[model samples]
Target: MIKFAYTILYVQDVQRSLEFYETVFGFTRKFITPDNSYGELITGDTTLSFAAHDLAKSNLKDGFMKSSNDNKPFAMEIAFSTDNVEALYEQAIKAGAIAEKPAEYKPHGQTVAYVRDLDGFLVEICTPME
Candidate 1:
């Protein structure tokens, strides 16, 4: 069977990115390399990982677009489902995440909000779909 294990975001600073996720999302740290170029967080069944730009460049022959707050967010986003969307949204902003939208109820009865992480990655905070 095929299963999704983790998603790695290429970031300028792996340690900083890992810390941001831990502080804003409350995910515990799994480990970071001694060089601080790569790290992982124990985010439930699927791990959330980060690789430094330099490390990622070495791994991929071709370069990739870098995320930046100055630019519009990418087409994709990482969503977190939570019962307390308002509280978490507030906390994320306070923890340095840029608020994209405030929590609002959708016609489907879900509460959703958006924010950009330090590296400009889109993050969605929302209520679980019923």
Candidate 2:
């Protein structure tokens, strides 16, 4: 017996990541601890958990990793599906995120681009192409 649902990614800075998700992807805050050590963001049924780097490592194999990693040319980016692409893209730019590629409509029916969050995670925000 097994259930399929939910995902949690290790984030570097809780406030920074919270800002990026809330501003860029329009995720609402589920909860934020006063110490800024733990928080959760919700977009519909999706739950994004943000745990402090120091705490995260301790939870690992005797604190294997000390910090969050900046996925460069290796790890896959997290893709978020949205109804509005351009608006979110612009908002992300205003939020101090660096956009590697400007948003563009594709023949494959997607208006998409990539933006780097505070921790260097690539986020792909997209909608159907025009």
Candidate 3:
């Protein structure tokens, strides 16, 4: 059976990205490479991972767009479901995530907010859909 396992974000600093997620989302470290080129977090069934930009480049022959705080975030986002969207959103901002939008209730009955991670990747803080 096919199963979704993990999502790895290419980042300039794998260690720094791992620490940001740990500090803001409270996910524990699973493992990191000896060279600090890659790391994973214990984020439930689907692990959240990070890989150093150089490592990522080596894996992909054509190269890829690198995330940056100076650029607008990409269209996609990684979402974290929580009971307290507001609190988590606040904590993310305090941990160096740029606020893209404040927490607000959606017409569909979910509370959602948006932020950009240190690497400029979009992140969604939201309540579970009932």
Candidate 4:
């Protein structure tokens, strides 16, 4: 049975991303590599593995690979669901995250907002419809 799964994101700077995640999501370090290429981050019941972009490219070479700066574009993102959307949104901004969309109650039924990480990965922070 699957107990849990972690999302691994590739970032340019480990410390910058680490500080952003830790501050915004309240994540605690579970483990960090000596070279800071990969690690586990825990917040509540979730564990996120953050890998440096260059390292991830090499790791994925066994499969079909593309340059991190390919012309076609290489990108990914993660959504952070939270209860106190407004407060977290404010905190995220204070933590140096650039807001892509202001928080609002969308017609689709959620209080949603968007922010781009240091590397331009979209992070949707939201609360489900009540």
lDDT of each: 0.94, 0.73, 0.96, 0.74
lDDT of 4: 0.74
* Local accuracy of candidate 4 as per-residue lDDT tens digits, 1-130: 7776777777777767787888888888888889988877886565777788778878785643332322323455577888778888888888877777888988888898887766566788899657
Model 2, span 1-130: residue lDDT tens = 6653455556667887888788777789998889888888886555777788777777787663322234452266777877877778778889877777878888787888887766666778888445
Residue 13 lDDT (model 2): 76
The pairs that clash in candidate 3 are none
| lDDT tens per residue, model 3, 1-130 | 9999999999989999999999999999999999999999999999999999999999999999998889988878999999999999999999999999999999999999999999999999999999
| RMSD after Cα superposition, model 2 | 3.0
Comparing 1 with 4 on lDDT, the higher-scoring candidate is 1
Model 4 pairs whose backbones collide: none
Model 1 whole-model lDDT (C-alpha atoms): 0.94
Which has the better TM-score: candidate 1, or candidate 3?
3
Select the stronger candidate by lDDT from 2 and 3.
3
| Clashing pairs in model 2, backbone N/Cα/C closer than 3 A | 109-129, 110-129
Model 2 lDDT on a 0 to 1 scale: 0.73
Ranking by lDDT: 3, 1, 4, 2
- Candidate 1 residue 109 Cα shift, in angstroms, is 1.0
Off by over 4 Å in 1: none
